[model samples]
Target: MDIYQICPEFKKGQITLRQTETQDAEELLNCYSDEAAVPLFNSDNCHGDDFYYTTLERMKQAIDFWDFSYKNRYFVRWTIIINDTEEIIGTIEMFHRIAEDEFNHFGILRIDLQSRFEKQEIINDILEIVNENLYQAFEVNSILTKAIPLAGERIQSLLNNGYSPMNKRFMGYDDYYRRNRVDN
Candidate 1:
């Protein structure tokens, strides 16, 4: 896969879209070890051997997915690597025909960051990345993103960046997951 050809939009002069996968997962793990990633990815609440195994499992899945190309087709999920470190900071995934057509475009399926780096500048940079990879350099009207109640600030940042929140409700988490799209 020509992963290097995907133009990267920079963040803090380092993170971009062109980084190599060789160092992606390991570096991401260091950042993923932060307090923020606990609730999001550590759903199994792992420790020691369990943590190591789980992390390895995750890395394996990532490599497999990245290497799995369908006849030169670009997969919907794009890994966002940090500038200086070149590790995956987050993922911007796009799923087509989401949940019976509740929304479209890229939905930020997952955003794991070092809780210490939760600043507006970083937030806006991510928005720029989203705009760069999204349809028409802007999030489509039909495309909407949803966050947990606790992610208010992050959601606000997106709105401030011109992403409008649609007034829609869902009945279940699984249903939302089934329909969730990514805004990469």
Candidate 2:
């Protein structure tokens, strides 16, 4: 399947994943500004302490970049909404990671959620959808996500969904996790 052909929205139980829009900048900025939610984000793209957007205007700029990236096929991202409250709770980003060297033909998944919504079940549910369909969408042989040491709940969810800590020597990055299609 062409990556762009993937649906703009997906529903799984209490959560709904929809294409993010410019209007979501406010809520999304709130999530990013949350003291508890900020640290859990992947530092690769987030750039650790350097990645901060303290205002709606800046967040809108970031959202614009996300939209531009999507248009260029750099990656696909969605705003996560809680069905019951109809609240925007988080965001999910996935991109094809195909390189000529190592880590070829893989999908890199990044999920950022509000601290309150960071539950094992919720994380599992979100990832299950990606695991089920991302291979086809990105034509990847495996999916990988980082679960930092402090992210115990996310680590557990990943384990429950068949992900294992990638070898330190092979990964060269400590504590990174992976779920290969063959493992499923």
Candidate 3:
């Protein structure tokens, strides 16, 4: 499917995944500014550094970059909202892995959340949505994500959502989880 035509808004129960906007800078700042929460964010795909925005200005800059990337067909990103509070709590960014090597034909998912919302249930719910639809969303047969070994909560959530741990011998520091359509 054409990337531009694939934008979608997803909602299941209390969580809503929608296109992020410039106005979200402040809330996103709040989510990423938490000193404790910053370290838990996974940034393996973010050009080697964690895309943690500690201030509103930085968050806005990141949002601009996200917009530029979207316009350039680089990736798609969405802000996660808690319906009850109507507040942005996290973000999910994903792109089709179009490399010529081992990662060919895979969708890369990057999820960053405020420490408070990093519960197994919540992670499973959000990841479940991505796992079920990402194949078609990115037109790939499988999806991959990275969760460090020290992130026990995240590892459990990935396991609960049909993702199997990739071999450590091949993955080293990138504790990877993979879900393929054929697995069903």
Candidate 4:
């Protein structure tokens, strides 16, 4: 499916993933400005964006850029919301990589969340929903995400969800884990 043509929304339990909007700036500011969560964000190959916005204006600009990127088919970003509290906790970015290296045609998944929700269970819940859909949505052989050594909970969750450490570096970045669509 062409995700850019029709962005799909996924809902599972209290977690909801939908196309990000400008209205998300206020709540998402809390996630972008979160110092503790910033380090866990995968900003590799993002042209130094770093994903750290300190103000509402900056966050809005970032959202605008995300919209631009989506329009150009560069990537799709979704806001992660809690159904119960209706809080925007974070965002998930996914793109189809077309490179000359080993990652060519692979789906790159990036999950950024508030520091307080960085537990293994939370990560598992989020991944459970994404893993069930992104492979088909992005039409890729595998999906890759970053989980540095410091992100112990994220690493464990990835492992439990059938992901493994990729021995090779991704676009000169490290600490990436991979999950294939078909089991080997």
CA-only RMSD, every prediction = 6.6, 2.2, 2.0, 1.4
lDDT for each candidate structure: 0.46, 0.81, 0.80, 0.91
| Candidate 2 lowest-lDDT run of ten | 43-52
Candidate with best TM-score: 4
- Score candidate 4 by TM-score against the native: 0.96
Per-residue lDDT, model 4, residue 56, is: 96
**Model 3 agreement with the true structure over 35-81: per-residue lDDT tens digits:** 76777776654576576667788889889999888998888889999
Count clashes in each candidate, considering only residues at least 3 apart in sequence or on different chains.
Answer: 10, 0, 0, 0
Q: Tell me the TM-score of each prediction against the true structure.
A: 0.60, 0.90, 0.90, 0.96
- Checking candidate 3 for backbone clashes, the offending pairs are none
What is the lDDT ranking, best to worst? 4, 2, 3, 1
Off by over 4 Å in 2: 5-7, 45-51, 169-172, 182-184
In the range 56-137, model 2's lDDT, one tens digit per residue, is 9888887898888898888888999888888998799988876785787788888888888889978988988887877777
**Two-way lDDT contest, 3 vs 4, winner:** 4
Supply the TM-score for candidate 3.
0.90
- Candidate 4 steric clashes: 0
